[model samples]
Target: MKTTITPRVRTLVLLFLAVVGMLFAGAGTASAHAALTGSDPSSGVVVNKAPTQVSLTFSEKVATNNDSLRVLDPKGKRVDVGKPSNISGTTYATQIRSGLPDGTYTVAWQVVSADSHPVGGAFTFSIGSPSKTTVSAAAEQDVGGGLVGGLYGFGRYMSYAGFIVMVGGAAFVLACWQRGAGVRALQRLVVSGWVSLTAATLWLLLLRGSYTTSGKFGDIFDLNLLGQVLQTKTGASLVSRLLLLAAAALFIAVLFGAYDKREDEEKRDLTFGLAIGGGVVAAGLAASWALSEHASTGLQPGIAMPVDVVHLLAVAAWLGGLTALLVSLYRAPADNPVGRATVQRFSRLAFGSVVALVATGIYQSWRQLGSWSAFTDTGYGQLLLVKIGLVALLVGIASISRRWTGRLADSDTDTAKAETVVEETAAAEEHEPEKEHVTASAKTGGSSAASGDPKRAAQLARQQVAVDTTRQKRLRDADPNLFGLRRSVLAEAAVAVVVLAVTTALTTTEPGRTEEDAKAAKASSSSSSSSSSGALTLDMSFDTGGKDGKGIIRVDIDPARVGGNEMHVYVQRPNGRAFDVPEVKVAFTLAAKKIGPLPVTPDRITTGHWAANGIQIPMAGDWKISVTVRTSDIDQTTVDKNAQIG
Candidate 1:
């Protein structure tokens, strides 16, 4: 069978693979993802006695330092049991020191997962040994042990693994797989894609029940679990697309293999076509998982979806393709000319693929890094960096193979042998010109010969031994080529393992969430428990567009009278911090004491919050104010004030 294995075809295939492979490799190196597993004093379980400690379990390891779990008894009482630790490789436990005695107790815990996700959950436990007790909603809300804490932990790990594999696999194809060569490359891709697709299906099925029940059995026919996973806002969109792509890859695979019976060349082309098709499918699945995780975290779906999708597709190709390349080389038929051609083609393509991977990876790193501290302080970012390091190492290895290693030279073995012989001959000839070198070597040898005390003959022998030792040492230090291929392969594989582990970490983390948590805490503290100005219930009332055609202000100060008109009121800023104002100067549009000697007074009601009783409003519209307070310790300041009067 005639095969048109043109250089152009190989180049084209390599170009295509390179772009996609790098992207996939970049996406698989993050790990900071931890979700809640199960908690003790289980949800909806009414206990007669107050348990001493509240315990929770996680699917993976958790950082022991700076992470905590607390259980609050009824009436907002702190009843946390004990210190939380990762006793087992996978489980994290915390003891409840003070015994819990309550109508309902809530266990609110926050901790760092193996991947660095600070996962938290709350559950309620009842106390007081009684004959019969029932778990009620009121009791649940008081301490509200959430239903999802433990189950989410397991789901999180599973999803993390799935994403890393899918992304890593795609990266492998993009960065490592050779196009227009290797009859089996395509078959391997197809096989991998089919397996992942099948796994997704099974996972969704189990997820259907787990979503509803927190966790599910690890078996087939988990229709209920599958249904729930399929029903979720993000899950439905992601899983549906993956399934479609998987089916398509299978069809492409059949077409490729079908031509194998007709001709040998046909089989080679089929292999190339099939591999490309499989990479596409694998990329699709990787993207689905990446985007879905972003969506789950409540980010704007519009931005998160595309950023993550693109990120995953690129990563999957690089990692998956690389793996495929490694596997092919390990098992390829040594004598097959076609296979050898494919290997060479793949090596060429890998360079380009790595470039693309770096570009996309940089973009992703910038987006998810959020802050510089995340690189060193956050678990997720560290894992991602490790992955990147491994990738760089892998690229280094590839470069050596392609450029420095004799394998890629046009006349590899011959060139190496020639170079070695020439070098040896030059060394022998240079013994005289390098007189100082030879003389020094001879002196060292003479000293050693003295220990033997065998006259001039032994001294000469010692000189030769010294020279040989120096040469051998230099060779060992400067040349790795002397080592067998097996050593090189082992070194590369060791590096690969480190990279894979980092990829696992990145999969679990929610890109970046540490910044978000801080912002959220600040917001919760500042925002009003309800509306502050809506349907004013307090004594103070302000009218906008009032009688004077300006702002009118009213002050209904509710405070225990101090000296003149002292009132203590809590002043809160929008960001949830206490604020103070000096002597207030009120006016219609703006506030200044220049126009009139404004009669206003500002005093600290409680240490921070400032208040004014019977403050005057000059105009009718929405009156604005500037309260200025003077003090010895701190300089006096004025703050913007607003009041509406009818």
Candidate 2:
């Protein structure tokens, strides 16, 4: 028999297609996580004179506290004269004192993205000539590390898991599996989800305090630190989530009768009110996550934040419902009518949720990754691809469950039709016999024992045939499709857990835009280094063991422009004695440009002296020059020096 598509099913299918079409139609330009895009005086650049101020530009508006931006001289002394000023929406600048010395300076900066996440980095620029100082880049402030960091990540994961369980479980009870509403196992799942979310939120608050303060485990309970964090937007978001959880607890208690021994069927009005109120609270809770995450900072916050909330809810509903379905399948009888009905209902609900999830995910991907290249080039984009692949697999598994549901529906239809046939046959046999008896009475003018014998026998035979047919239908081999569906749903739920973990990790990664910008800056700096005029000189020291353990190796690159150049090196002992080595060689590499370590075999001009002409400098940047000397077969040592091409 052909299956008829009900009007309700058609409506749902239309809605699903419409939403999907709208998502594809509204696809827009991509964006990325907030990151530094450009800066004044540019990193690794050589300026003719000291800049009076340094400016940093980010891809999005950011927030910062005092000391968020600083400039340090070659000697590691702070040179920035005052606190940074927000020159524009995404630009921050800090002034430096006039008449500064001509030396390399490092710019260190840390700021909070609009969404409340902290980002920081450091780079160097030179005034006049590059110096030989060993000042390292500014180190990032530790938010949390080791055990604390692990715990924080775990807490975040728990929060996500809890949301899916609580929201999804409650939705399943109200919509699909109403018969299982009062079951203790289902009730515990909801209660556990609620408790987990509340505890995770509170734990995160304390961890955030320690993260922003001293990055020490001991500071987790610091009252002052907690007070400071509570003043920030992140703190406010967490607090709001806690409040929503509290309200949800009340809704779950009253609506589901979680605390009562008996079902509260008399309070239908109260149940309805609690449901509507609970939905509002749940939405508010989702909004809290959006407010403190990448959605609020990266792209069009007005649109991205709301879409993120929807995306989160849809994921919870689908995955959470799957979890509930698995539990129901395990506990209920294989052929239970209620269990079968609940599975069919949940299948429909999950289909709708999946459509919504896909739509929102597409929009989010566009907002976060600006270009196609980012998909392979950036870590964030790579992780997103993995998530997409996993979701596709999950969808494939869900299709199997859907197929099984259809089979089950068909089986039910066949059984109902057989029962109807049996009922009709019995009704016909009763009425036919009565009519035959009336005819016989009229013909014989008196009651007869064998009245209408043939007709009665035919009627009885037809009734027996109907009874046999009904029994055959009832005895048909049981379908194993429901068992198969239960297994498929279980598989989907397992995969969903992995997806959630990946999502949590993605949130903490640097945005692709920042990584791309950093790569571009490095390439630009290398290109500029090759275009300068002047010879480059570098001093290196080597320990060759024995009496001549300490020796000085000096290199000279005449007119050290890119392409061919003459290179020379001199070696001397610490006491000004000529360090005579049997063989000496020089190797050069420009790592930033991925240039090779080209060996330059210089001729021994004199003792402790070497020279080579036609040495290729290649494209410049900071090149590492290594000088190797062999005093004996077993006593050889190499020393390295940085040769600034400019």
Candidate 3:
């Protein structure tokens, strides 16, 4: 029982821990907060007129503190929609002042959610015109796919899978890495899991530069922005704290491992200490996920850091343990029967690991998604289904490997028995060397023995050759079964890759709606009463106010439309030359809408003129004009932008 760590084992341990670290650090980068699932106004809604306010609802409850939503008009300008608010008191909302005229507008949002992950998006909607600004409700922007997107996706997959692996792996390895493993392995596992956790902290700090810049491979040293990001919650500051905690756990484990290493096998009292430490670390990491999403808020304390930390550590223990076992199996010096014994022991551990993984996965999903209907109703549910399917595949592969393991182990017994029999027979044949070697006297058995009993000698030589061959050969029958084990392990690895791919995809897709809009329009369709359209022919875009020559204008809009009424706008100069008024385009925005050419575009886009270009200024006062911005079949938004002839 040498205390010195062997270089090979040390290398194996280091590599295994590094993988765990990558898994953890990457877990928060690309995932969570239930995705957009579905929005109240949806991404792009054209209305007959403006609504009272704009709302965005996700599959889960989200934050609405500080910043959340942004509304932009066609000219790429930010329209002060309103202070962000939560629609269901769950997601975000922004009250747009009522009189905005039709055109195209964009709604951009970012938030941290209960899962403690950042999510953001931009969508378009046109007034009067058919605007389907939604890119793909089910399509998630993933990490490694594009800058921040990929990080989020990667982090998500890691968070979920890492929990199962790290937790289960820790338990498995703990029970088997040593005799008194619940305690002994727990301490080491903590240390092992922490190194990467620390590395992730540093890497995340470095990663914020990617956020400040447009893409990956950008300047890693943007000092001022870097410092700012570290200071900000969405950036390095938060991740750093997680890393520091993970580091602390690691240092504690190292001390624990050192102390335990000195204790006798008879006095292995590591379990109590290890369990207490593990419980604390688990609490810390799980809390981290609650604050990880972009949809989170101080108002809803549940969705912030705590849940995230828990999800992360649980996943790490489960997946991290699996990863460790895989490595241990791969590098094990199990050259003979004894080594195979260790393999058998791990196979049993793996069986238990799989069971624990399933239970935990179910628990976590339920806690996050809420209902079975959400599985298909929300975009997040759909992607989750895909990941689940992949997990099923992984299970199938594991089953195959298990079957092969049994066969291979059984073959070893048969092969050993046959070899023993051959050795016994060979020993008996050796007892009669003189008889077996007959031919001639020992003195004459040299060069010219052929002159004596050549035929007899030839028979003896053949027997000896056959006996030697049998002893040397490990029944060719055993080889195929042995190789089968290799195939099974390879298949598991392949399935594991598929799980990663599927999970990555899940990180991007929307969780979808908890309950889809049930409203059906008799002539037109919309889901909600407040969200429904009126019989109003209200042109979606009509301008009311703007200085004769000034580019900047303070325009207001009513967010809700009245029943059966048309909204109008008038844009004119103080001199009153409304003739040939071409090249006029009105761009509108609301939380529920997008930016595009108003459907009422009579004026060509080439000329930058609207449909009402140069008609006439009937009077010097405000004139009513119509602009069309069609969002849905019935939930259309008609906005009014105002301008007056001075």
Candidate order, lDDT descending: 2, 3, 1
Question: For candidate 1, lDDT tens digit of each residue in 536-626?
Answer: 1121111111111111122333321212323334433212233343333322243333333344554555644555565444443333433
Whole-model Cα lDDT of every candidate shown, in order? 0.45, 0.70, 0.46
Instruction: Encode model 3's per-residue lDDT on 1-646: one tens digit a residue.
Output: 1111245356544654454445444544444443453343444566666665667655456544434676666665566455787554344677766676677767766665444345666666666665333333322233223555445334444444443444444454444454223243344444444554554455556655453233354645667657756555556335745664655556355444554465555325664565566566555555444444422432223442344454445445434555544544333322222124444666676666556556656654654354576676666677678778877876777677667666654536644754665566556556867534542233353333476877655666665554444443333223455445544664565455455555545434333321121110111112212222321122121222221121111112222232122223333221122212333333423222232222333433232222333222223322233243332234322334322221
lDDT, candidate 2, 56-104, per-residue tens: 8775677666677888888888888877899965779999988989988
Top candidate, metric TM-score: 2
Off by over 4 Å in 2: 1-32, 47-52, 96-102, 137-147, 212-214, 258-271, 331-338, 406-482, 511-646
| Most lDDT-accurate candidate | 2
Q: Number of clashing residue pairs in every model? A: 82, 0, 149
User: Candidate 3: where are CA atoms >4 Å away?
Assistant: 1-74, 77-145, 151-172, 179-196, 205-267, 290-319, 334-349, 363-378, 400-487, 514-646
> Model 2, poorest ten-residue lDDT window?
23-32
Can you give the TM-score per candidate against the true fold? 0.47, 0.62, 0.50
Q: Which regions in candidate 1 have their CA more than 4 angstroms from the true location?
A: 1-120, 123-193, 211-213, 216-225, 245-252, 259-283, 295-304, 337-341, 404-406, 409-490, 514-646
RMSD of 2: 20.5
lDDT of 1: 0.45
In model 3, the worst 10-residue window by lDDT is 517-526
What are the C-alpha RMSDs, in order, of all predicted structures?
Answer: 18.9, 20.5, 17.1
